[model samples]
Target: MEHSFHYLLLANQATVHRQLLAKLKDTGLTLGQPKVLDYLQDHDGANQAEIARACHIEPASLTSVLNRMEVKALVERRTQKGDRRSFAVYLTGQGHSMALRVRQAFEELEEQAFAGVSEAEREQFLAVFRRVYGNLKEGER
Candidate 1:
């Protein structure tokens, strides 16, 4: 029976994420994997650590995802030149194609989610959301 705006906002967020997961599932990717691929699409051949940071994922989690992606032949990790201990990640041809799909999936989701909502309303909502997020994050730092 929570009537607070926070409850409504959280509920909406959960629903949207669930729908996004469903959409991405069709492409054989989990929630986080597409983000990694999307980032790498723009910054190909990035190191594992860089990719993890850019994708807002932990190194261990990125390692697990990369392992799965490697098995799928979507990405390959090669030893960095002059740094045999470090690896650079590169997308295979399959991965490049999948990345395109991932981008399209995200665009479709956004379009569907915002259907019938005017641009001004969307901008105002985003402004408010960012303020709320900042307020909550203030305590963490």
Candidate 2:
């Protein structure tokens, strides 16, 4: 099979994700969990639906992830006022501390991924990536 830009893109993404996951293993965080923690770091107390949308995950999948996070003592879910079926999510103290570590780990991983790439080349790659991302999202509502 001939490799194309899409192949390279996905391959790179997989490599980066693998590296981040390895680093996060010590903290007991999985691949997608960091994205949720990062979102809640800024938007603490968001409801599950809001978090699902923000995290680009299905509500059912988010429910599972939140359950795991809760078990890990990283987050808490509270019943929302006037809505028994709804709950607001908040990061626990431990969650907040782990979020900081997650952020640092991601920074280090990113640096490692881009090591030895010149600033100009990095900027050019980013510009191209933005255009590609926009193109892919053109039909998104």
- Strongest candidate by lDDT: 2
- CA deviation > 4 Å runs, candidate 2: 1-3
Model 1, range 32-124, lDDT digits (tens) per residue? 788888888998899999999888789999999999999988899999997898999999999999888888877888888789999999999
Q: Write the per-residue lDDT of candidate 2 for residues 70-109, one digit (tens) a residue.
A: 9999999998897889899999999999988888887898
TM-score per candidate, in order? Answer: 0.79, 0.86
Which candidate tops TM-score?
2
If candidate 1 were superposed on the true structure by all CA atoms, what would the RMSD be?
2.6
Q: Which ten residues in a row have the lowest lDDT in candidate 1?
A: 23-32
What value does the lDDT take at residue 20 in candidate 1?
Answer: 70
